[model samples]
Target chain A: SAVISQKPSRDICQRGTSLTIQCQVDSQVTMMFWYRQQPGQSLTLIATANQGSEATYESGFVIDKFPISRPNLTFSTLTVSNMSPEDSSIYLCSVGGSRYEQYFGPGTRLTVT
Target chain B: GQQVMQIPQYQHVQEGEDFTTYCNSSTTLSNIQWYKQRPGGHPVFLIQLVKSGEVKKQKRLTFQFGEAKKNSSLHITATQTTDVGTYFCAGEDTGGFKTIFGAGTRLFVKA
Candidate 1:
């Protein structure tokens, strides 16, 4: 299994500002993804981070809002540009492991005032 | 896009009781996985089912994949306070590697 880590466990930002969350994996992985979870809600896939390529975002999400960068198999980043109160959520990074099991990072909780 | 639905969004059980959560997918899933997330914690993989009509057990936990590959279930026997968490089921679609997560079932174990 893979061990994933995220930076800035929790942060408070002002509206219109931005926050970049980092994800690191202990081992190389072919699939890396970003997700968001609102309070008392389920996880929502944000985008897929592909090494050396642009991220594939899910519907209702755009690069201008959440730009992703994957320099290699072991690291990735997601930036919440122009933050707003609605953008406040817990951002999680995940990597596919052996079989269908996937490991997730500790998650970065962002609160935009 | 594929979607997964989980039943009984919220469940409360006394310690030592049993609890179960069901997940249904709109399309045939190539693989199904279960994850557990404690309060204020990230999701951690619990198990995965790839074969149809498969059943696997881990201590007090039991996981099942339906014959149609469109549904799955997670059962926890003799639930404890430590078992209080949210359970999510994710499905891998046929063509792409896109993984979709279910709404999740929140379990509360009252000691």
Candidate 2:
């Protein structure tokens, strides 16, 4: 089991502004992922943050919009750039756990107005 | 791109009733995992099923992986108010660590 935490548990931002969410894990992990959950919607994988390389984003996501930085094994940051009202959702950081299960952070709820 | 489909997006049941959510994947999965998320909360891992035709029991919750490894289900017996949340099923692709999540089934238990 891994202890994960995210900064800025909840934040309200104005349109066109960017917010960087940080994820810290208790131990070193090889695989880390970022997810987004819209209101009353399911979780969607935004990108996979690798320890020493560029992040692999999903189909609907682009690096210009959501830039990710993974400097080390236990830390990563996701920046939501040029935010809009549609970007209001819960952003989660998860680490791959034993037996293929992923442990999630408390989540950072973002509201773009 | 792999996709996992979950049925009955929303369920409402009285306390002590049984509830189940089904998940199906377009491609064969290496493993399946279940998660529960309360309102305004992040998802918490419940259990993982690796082998085909595997069934795991965690108290009142039972998780099953299909024989074909492309489907899974989570059944809760004698549901309670504590079970009011969204249940998600995630599948990992074969030979890869990427996981795809289902739309989730929101369970509403009336006490």
Candidate 3:
């Protein structure tokens, strides 16, 4: 099991403002992913942050909107650029554990007004 | 792209009643994982099924993987108030790093 933490647990941002969420894992992990959960909706994968190199984003998400930086094995950052009211959701960072199980952070709740 | 679909978007069950959620995939999966997210909480991993036709039990919860690896189910026997949450099934494809999650089934328990 891994202990994962996310900074700025809850925040309210105005439109057009960007919020960068940081994820720190207690131990080194090979795979890290960013997910978004809208109000009354399911989890949507934004991108997969690799230890090095570029992150792999999902089809509906783009790097220009959600840029991810994984500088090391135990840390990563996801920046929501030019945020809109639609971007208001809970952003979660998860690490793949043994046997394909994923341990998730407490998640950063963002409300854009 | 792989897609996973879950049935019964919402369920209302009385306390002590049983509840079940089904997950179907468009593609065969290497493994399927179950997660539970309480209201206003993040998702917590429950278990993962890797073998075909495998069934695992944890307390009152039972998870089953289909022989085709394209479907799975989670059944909770004698649910409690703590069982109220959204259940998600995530399927991982062979040789793929991405895991696709189902839309999830929200369980509402009335005590």
The prediction achieving the highest DockQ against the true structure is 2
Report, to 2 decimal places, the DockQ of model 1. Answer: 0.88
Error of 1 at A7 (Å): 0.9
| Clashing residue pair totals per candidate (backbone < 3 A) | 0, 0, 0
Interface RMSD of each: 0.7, 0.6, 0.5
lDDT of 1 at B37: 97
Q: TM-score each candidate.
A: 0.98, 0.97, 0.97
What CA RMSD would you report for each candidate? Answer: 0.9, 1.1, 0.9
lDDT of 2 by residue, B1-111 (tens): 799999889999999999999999999999999999999888999999999999999999999999999999999999999999999999998968778899999999999
Report, for candidate 3, the interface RMSD. 0.5
DockQ of candidate 3 (2 decimals): 0.89
> Candidate 2 chain A, which ten residues in sequence have the lowest lDDT sum?
A94-103
Among residues 3 or more apart in sequence or in different chains, the pairs in candidate 3 whose N, CA or C atoms overlap within 3 Å are none
lDDT of 1 by residue, B1-111 (tens): 688999989999999999999999999999999999999999999999999999999999999999999999999999999999999999998878888999999999999
lDDT of 3 by residue, A6-84 (tens): 9999999999999999999999999899999997888899999987799999899999999999999999999999999
lDDT (C-alpha, whole model) for all candidates: 0.94, 0.95, 0.95
Q: In model 3, where do residues sit more than 4 Å from their true spots? A: none
